[model samples]
Structure formats: C-alpha cells, structure tokens
Target: MPLPTGPVIGIMMDNLKKRKSVFPISGRKAVKWSQKLEIPVGGETVLYTGSMYQLLPYMIAAVNRMGKMEDSFLGQYVGLGRFFNKMFNVSSIMFRPKRADHKRFRRIIRDIARLLQQAGVDFGYLYKKELYAGALAFDLGVDETFVAHAQRLSNLFKAQGVRSLITIDPHTTNVLRSVYPTIIDGFDIEVKSYLEVLAENDTLRPINKVEGEITIHDSCVYARYEDVVEQPRQLLRRAGYTVKEPKNNRNLTHCCGGPIESLFPSMAHQIGGKRVQQLKDAQGKGVATMCPICMATLQQAANGDLEIDDIASFLAKAFCPPGANDKSAEEKRSQP
Candidate 1:
C-alpha cells in the first residue's frame, strides 16, 4: 500500500499556513545561527536564508518517524494525527530532532555566512523577520496557500527595504528568484545564490589550499531552473578542490529524493540511495551538496559509506581565516 500522502501533506501545509514555516519552528530558532556573526538586521542586499537549513533537521526527524509508519498498519493512523495537528502543533510533540543534527546544520549556515564574509560581501540578515520561502507548498501545488505566503513575504521584503537577496540554498534561490516574480505583481527583488556571489568576487581567494577531489551534487532547482550549475563549480575550483562530476550532473542532475520525503519516505530513501551510489561511482574523495535537502537526504542514504557534506563547509575551511569555526573567536574578530 502507498503511504497516506493526503494527511501527511495536510499536516505540512497546515503548519506552513499557520506558522509561516513548513515546520513549526520559531523565528528566533530559525535565525539563531546568525546571532554570533553579528549580521545587521536588514539591508538593501540581505542574506536571505529562507529558513531552509534551520527547518531541515526537524523535517528529517519528522520524515524518519513517518517512514516507520509508511505502508504499514500504523500508517492509517496518520489521519488522526492530522486531525490533532489542526487543533495544535502535533509536529513539535512528535518530532524532536537530535541535538547533534541541529548543531551540524547550524554550523553549515555559519560556514555559509563565513564564506560570504571572507568574500568581502556586505550583507545583512533579516533575523526574526526572515520567513520560509514556501518551497514545499509551491512544490506540492498548494497554490492558494503559496500565493498568500508569497504575497506576505513580498510585503516583508518591501517593508524592510530589501532590494537584492543573497540566498544560501537552491530551493530558496529558485523560488525567490524565478517563481515569486511570476506570481506576485511588482515583485522586483533581485535574488542570487551565495555561491554565485562568492564565485563572481575575484578578490575572495582561498587562504588554505584544499587538496582532494569531491563529487558535486547539482540541485535540480539550481541547475535547471536557476542556471546555478557553474557557480558552485567555479567556487570549488577556486577553493583548490578538484571538482568531480557525477554520472547524472548539471541539467541532468538526479534528485536526492528529498522533495517527496514528506509524502513518500520509503521511496525518497530509495531514490537517495541510488543517487549516493551514483556519487560513489564518480570516485571522488567525498561528496559536496549545494542543497540542504540534498545534504540531509544523501547523508541518510549513504549511511556512513560515503562522506557527505554541504559545499559551504568545504569552502569555509579553505577560505575562512583560522578561528572562524569558533563562535566566540569569530564574534571577537568581527568586532570593529
């Protein structure tokens, strides 16, 4: 039997519709990673996280619980959970992500910020004002909800005086750049992925040369939708890491099975496993993923067989100065 997708999607959509996030994470929690960096609140060209990385750990935890129930006798009871979710936030009670997982994802976001700073990019964060880009709702075809959310986000950006956006993840970059303008009138915000920003800055050279070949997992949204295929590669090459291409790469990049994980956990796992194997076939020292979903999904599938990390983690190690990894040290260094 197929998983009960209707109730599952309903739970997620309800969370997004009510909480402004696909998962019910507080805005404070969403922006916690940037606190230590002392990024100013809002600017013309802001670093818009879209809360993708912050929400992934919770999303993954929820999917893991759901996967156990999928296609089994327990799966039928998910509708009951949806019923309670409407009354209260059931996801908060049902899915508690591991502390270590939360820390890892938080570090990835910090690394991204560090990379941007090292590149001499002057950007501010929206902090608690930051909102999820409604990628899941947009992807799942909840048109009404997505449209409303998009309008709200557009209003937030305009009110904050945001002109251009430096997005961290592929989904946010694609939706904010390509989809938002199509749906919302007068949506003129310029969106570019941080990779593109870093790649274009010639002054941001790697201080420590990293010697190893890493396979690149191109995000479908970034590759086909946003033409972000070359930016990450250029940055990686400049960071002194030899880029390896997976069999299905660039425009033909394979899905990490993450987009559908909320609905079909087992199937998504199978797809992730296949993609991991494809990366292994590339025979690189490790795998680098530009998408948060890709990193989470592929890491789960790899199961310690392969080393999988976000592309920013690699760049941060090479480009960021010593003590950049320590929050206190970085805070002191950024103090001017």
Candidate 2:
C-alpha cells in the first residue's frame, strides 16, 4: 500500500551542489532510500553559510575543481546554474511544478525558505518547509542537529513502522547512536552504521592487498556514536595492512571539525590540522574514514597533507580472498 500523504518520514538533508567531492554518488541515494523506507536521515546545515565555514568548502572546491575558480569563471558557471534553477522553479510555480508532487521536496524547500528568511535572504520565502536540516551544532563541532532530528524521528516510530535508523558516517552515526538515545525521548529506533552492514558479507572483503602502512581515523561518529572501535580496525587488519591508531583514538576521538566549518572555517582547519597531525604522528601513509563526507571534508581540510580514503574505496582497491570477487558475491550484496 502507498503511504498516506501527511507526516511522511522526515529526512533532513544538506542541499545539493553541482559538483560535490565530499559526498559519494552512493551516499545520498543510500540515505534517501533509508528515509523512503521510514528511516529518518538528517544532516548539519544543508548549505554553505557565509561564515568562516565557507572557506573550507571554497578550499575543497578549489582543490577539486581543477580550474573553475580563476578569473570569474566560477560565478559564470555556478552562478548560471543557480540562476536557472530558481528561474525553472519560478516558471514551474507560475505554471506546474514536479516538486509539488513530491511531498518530501516540498517540505524541505519550505524549511530552506524559512532559514533563508531568518538569515535574511530576501527571496520572498521560496519554500514552505525546511528543505535542509539546520546546522547540527553552532560551531566548535557538535552533532546536536542529528540527535535532535533522530529524537524527532523517535516520536514517529510507532506509526512510521521504523524500527531502525542508519547513518553513512561516523559523525552522524555517533550522534544517532549515542547522543540521541541519551536525549529527548531517545530515538527508540535502532541506529546502524552502513559499514557494519556492509561488513556482514564475508565475500565483500577486499580484492587486493592495500600495500603500505595505513591508519584508521575512528570518526567520532563510529567510535563514540556506536562504539564501533574494533570493527574497522579488524577490517583494515584483515585487508593485510598494519593499522595504527592515534593517541586520542576510539570514543575519545576528536572531531574533524566539520561541524565548525560553517562558523569557523579556520577553526575547522585547526581541528583538521590536529587530526592530520595525528595520522602523521602515527607515520601512516594514508588515512581511512567510514564516511565519504568525512573523507572529502578532511582531505580538503588537510590540504593534501595526508591521503584520505573511504572505507569502501579502500576495500574495493585492496586484495580480496579467492572467490570473493565472483559474481555470486556481488549478487548477494544487492539482495536488500
């Protein structure tokens, strides 16, 4: 049966950017489906604010954009896209809108309009709902928004038929797993991190040995959010590489300062600098993070100081045992 219209499971997502290096193609879809199935997903501020946090995003884009930032080229390219999107929406509003059929999109856009109004965007409220989740925390890096959103999700579990929530990264996972349960009514929903499920299939192991010394940044989300300290370490070790942990490893792991990016881009740098220093201190050749967002954000923040790899990418490129690379294995992974 189709779900009734009102009060559908809420997913507080970040805004969509044209060329995002931080989020993987799969990350957004993975979370989208999770929300569609009644599992709620949330994020920090959906868009880049004009605060210092803008610097990291700008920096990340410059590093990844190759040559888009030079001599007014960026505004010409990105500006035109934003212009067309609004124009398309306005024209659609003047006539018909595909988004009107999408309750989720409608709701998020409304929220975005409100935030913009509060931030004073003077666009006459282009929406009626909060299209993007607000910042998780007000700077200094915290997961308050995730926890609050999850708790809000907890309020709907009975009717939504949602028993579990899943997060793609450690930052989100940590808040959903630990902090949320301790606050509000406590999201009674079971929150699972994606990698744990991905690890369920033994055949899903690495394909080739990732040679060289490697270290895992037990994201605050994975380590503190869900006590996922040992699993990633074990996975990395099994993939035939020595795993070195920073002194402040596990639950005590420091924030990569991603949440602070919006308020203090430089502070985000300071935090990221500390994290990279830890990896360097360990003398590891590369760093692995479970969240694509983390991998991208930290890589940008590190400014090429250390190599950052997502766990999946790390596993995909590394050696796998015999038969693990077979067709049957791939088929099984897509079963759900």
Candidate 3:
C-alpha cells in the first residue's frame, strides 16, 4: 500500500474524529505540479502516512526528563550545540557519553527506552491531539507539518516490507519512526540512525594517498535530533582524505539553519560562516558534510572560498591507487 501522493487532510481529520485508522496510508503530493524531492533510498519526496505521533513519545519523555533537571544545563546544551558545528560530527558532541553536562543525550536514551517500552504495552501510539496536547502541557512542541508528513512515511515504508528503517537525518528518523509509533499504533519497525548502519558494516578504509586535510560538519538532525556520528569520518579516511579538527564537532555540531530557515536566517548563515572559517584556520583544503542541508548552507556561506560537498559526493571522487583496475577507482566510484 503505497502512501497517497500527499496526506489526505480530510482522511486525517476523519480518522482523528473516528479514532480508527487505515494503517500505512499514503498522502497526496506535498508539492503540487508533479514535483518530487530527492531523498536517499529512493524516497521521492512524496507524502506518506504513518502513526500520528511516531516521534511524539520521545518528545514526551525527553521533555519530562529535561523538566526534572536544572534549567541552566539545558540552556548550556543549546549554546554548546551551536558552538560544536566545527570539527567533530554531531554524534560526537551529542553522544560523547563522557561529557558531564549532556542531559539531552541522557534524556534521549531514556526517551527511546520509554517509547520502546510503551510499544510493548500498547499496540503503538496513534497520531492524536492528545499526544500534542500532552507535550504542550509539558512545554514541548513539534511541527504540525512534520507530523503530517511523517505519518505518511511510516505507512508508506511499512507497506514496502520495511519493518526496520535507518533514517539518514535525525529529525525525520525520530519524528517518523520514534515518536509517532508511540502515539499512533506503536509500530514494530526498528529504527536506527544511518551512521550506525555504516559503522555496523565496518566500511572505514585506511588513510592512503589523500588530498590535503578537510573538516566535516555533522548535521544537527542526526546528532541532536537523532544521534548519528563517526561514520562520515571513517568514510573520509577510507576515501583517502586526512581530517582536520574544527572548534565544534559531534553533539554540539552547529545547525546548518536549514529546514529552520523559516525560523532563523542570519543566525544559520553566521553559523555556516563560522564553520568555514574554522576549516580555513585548520588549513584544511575542503569541507565535508553528511547532510544535503548542511552542504547547501556551507556552500552559500563559503561562497566558493572552500570546496563544500556531501560525503556521497566525495566518495564518488575516488583517488584510486596506481596499477589498480584499468577502470580507475574514481571510475568505479562514478559508476555507483
């Protein structure tokens, strides 16, 4: 059952009113004019349906945990998040595990645990106002559009025999797979961050004949919202590039100001500009990012002062060893 081209708002409201659901429903096209957006694994940016609150459960638990903690630590986490956009991947900063003040990391783990537990108790959470209202009561909120789109995605993927999903970006992954299932029906899908997939595959290659050093910017969605890290650096080393350290990396990775462009423009630009300068400071020759949103931001901010690219783009430029196959590794990289 492929999701509808875009969410059927009428159907959604009807479902809401009736408290019944047609699982794995699709939505109408998000953008009109026969348009599509590119996403990994062949997702064509078509709207899909899922549990009303696949990501809600985590939001709920996290808010509760954070509320029980000191306010200063939470504020500091925000500041550190922006500060960490430089060197390490978002996962490094957010999941450092060693950082004393990383309440979000702890809270995120707890939240996941709670959601998983809830799934065992109930079938799964359904999309509902109760979920949102519950979060708001706790002073937590998420986007309405995202929830709508995510529901369509969960239903779409499930129909495709994808009981487990590896989300490349944290925001989408968490919202679509984590919270909604908790709220809607508690889907049995296994959700893991994309970096974990790469690491699990052990794709890290040895550093060899490499171009000069480069710095990588981890997307906040993966680091903060989702918690992906390390895989990109491993890929860099495998691709024969030396990595440069930036002021901030990992958990504290700076937001590319994407998707959030509606919320803050100048702030995102400032963050991207600062990230580029850090690369220059380290004398790295180029900038690498795992997320397309970050790639666009760095390019706009770098303004061609530096080479900005996504990890996939870089992998496609394989600097192969001499006497390799007649078809150069670069050629093979190009093939895929």
Candidate 4:
C-alpha cells in the first residue's frame, strides 16, 4: 500500500500556516520550559527553540498513531483526517502524547537553557513570540508556505530587536542560519547552535566530572549543512566522557529516519533501527542525540535495547550542580 505522504504533509503545512507551529501546540505550552528559568523577553541575542523540542512528543505520538493507521485498514481515512484537520484540529484529537513524554521533552529544553546559563551565555527568550522555523514545510518542499512563514518569523525578529539567535536544535539552526537568509530579504539574524556557543566558551567546563563512554548521533542537518559536527564531540570530551563514534559519524552520519517519520512511519522506524544497530556496534554506555527528532526516533527503534538521550541532558548532568535548576527534582520535592 502507498503511504499517504501528500495528506500527511498537507496537514503539517496547514498547521504551520495557521497555528505557526508544525503541531497544534499552543505558544504557552511551547514556551513553558523557559517560564521557571525567568528568561527575559528579548535581547540582542535570544534563545530560539523553534518549538522543535516542545513539539517532539506530539510529533512522536502523531507518528505512532499514523504508523498504526497506515499499516491497518484505517489508512484510507487519512485524506478525510486531513480535511477535518482544516476545519477543526483533528491532530490534537488523534495525537495526544503521554504526560511522561511531554515532561521528558520539556525537561530537555530546560536542561538546554540551564546549560547555556551555566556557560555564562546571555540570551533571552521570545516566549510566545518565537515561531517554528517551518522546517517540515521546507523539507517537504512546500516553498510558498515556507517562504511566507519564514518572512513572518523574520518580521517577528525584527520587531523584537533580536540581533542574534542561540538555537537549540539542528533543523532550526540550519533553517534560521542558512535557509532563512536565502529566502527572506535582509534576514540578518546571527544564529549559532547552543553546542557551538558552549564549545567556544572556555568557562563552561564540566564541574561534575562524569565518567563513561557515550556514542554520538550526529544530526544530518547539523553535521552536513551547518558544520556542527565537532562542537558536540568537543563538549562531551570536555566533560570527561570518552566520545565513541559509530561507523557512520560526523559528516557521514546516518539519518535517524525522523524527517520522513510523519509520512512514512514504519519505514522511518526501520531506518532508525538500522542506525541504532550501528550505534550499538560502537559499544558505548549510551547514545547522545543533538536533535529532538533523532532522540525520539532512535529511542523508539532502540525500545530499551539501548539507552538514548539528548546531548543537553548529559551536558547538564556534567555542568550543573546537584539539584541546581532541576525542575524534575523540584517537582518531586514539592510532591509531598
């Protein structure tokens, strides 16, 4: 049976066009991770999430449901789903991620922010004003929609007085740093991945001194398009962990099968599983992913056979003091 690529992508583009996010997530939910951190409204340089991490749990849930629908008799209804999605948010109905999943991804975002703060990087958050980078629209080649969205984002930056961006993920970093400039006239935001910022900062050394070996799963956009290959490895090595390289690493990194997961879920899982095997061959304590999609996709493929985490989590564990800025620990402490 043919995958419902057109309908799936159509739904995503519609969401991007209408909601300003790839998923039906509200701006408050998108920016919730930064609330406790008390990040300022705007600054010369801002921490741009692009809603990638916040949207991941929702994306993962939607893809899981889509995979089942595609493999079963329900595949035929996808077109109808897309149609209903236009009138009403069918995605919110069909793709409700688990509470634990939501918390995990949110924690990753907080960890990233905490790591940046620990590194002494002065950055602000746009909060509700930050928009998704239209990565899926660009990846799916929806040029008209993507360009309009990019321009909208550029205008937001211009209005917010944002001169630079510290992006959290590879797709967002690549789009803002590379793609937006090509499409939007006078798009002059200086974008750098948080990894690059931390790697370049000499004062951001690890205080905890973690001991272990972790395999690095390089994001394709980061490694190939943005030259972000070395920054993550450098950060990990600086934290006292032996960086293990899979067979396909750095510029030659294999895809985590996430870009196509929405349209071809099972196929994406298959590709992710293969990549998981390659990482396992490296015989590390765990796998560290720089992209939320990579972490989610490879985790689904690993399914307890391997431990996978976002790179920020490891960095936070090494860089942050015990219980400092730890939301989960605070929550537990407040739980009675």
Q: lDDT (0-100) at residue 124 of candidate 3?
A: 22
lDDT of 4 by residue, 279-303 (tens): 9999999889999999889988988
Full-model lDDT, candidate 1 = 0.88
The segments of candidate 4 whose C-alpha lies over 4 angstroms from its true place after superposition are: 324-336
RMSD of candidate 3 to the true fold? 17.4
- What tens-digit string does per-residue lDDT give for candidate 2 at 9-58? 11111212221111112233212312322211222212211111212223
Q: Flag the better candidate by TM-score, 1 or 2.
A: 1
Rank all candidate structures by their TM-score, best first, as comma-separated numbers. 4, 1, 2, 3
**Per-model TM-score on C-alpha atoms:** 0.95, 0.51, 0.50, 0.95
State, as a TM-score between 0 and 1, how close model 2 is to the true structure.
Answer: 0.51
List candidate 3 stretches off by more than 4 Å: 1-148, 202-210, 319-336
All candidates' lDDT scores? 0.88, 0.43, 0.43, 0.87
lDDT of 2: 0.43
| Stretches of candidate 2 exceeding 4 Å from the true structure | 1-160, 179-187, 198-204, 319-336
Runs in model 1 deviating more than 4 A are 326-336
Report the lDDT tens digits of candidate 3 across residue range 33-72: 1122122232222112122222222222222233333233
Please list the Cα RMSD from the true structure of every candidate, rounded to 1 decimal place: 4.4, 15.3, 17.4, 3.0
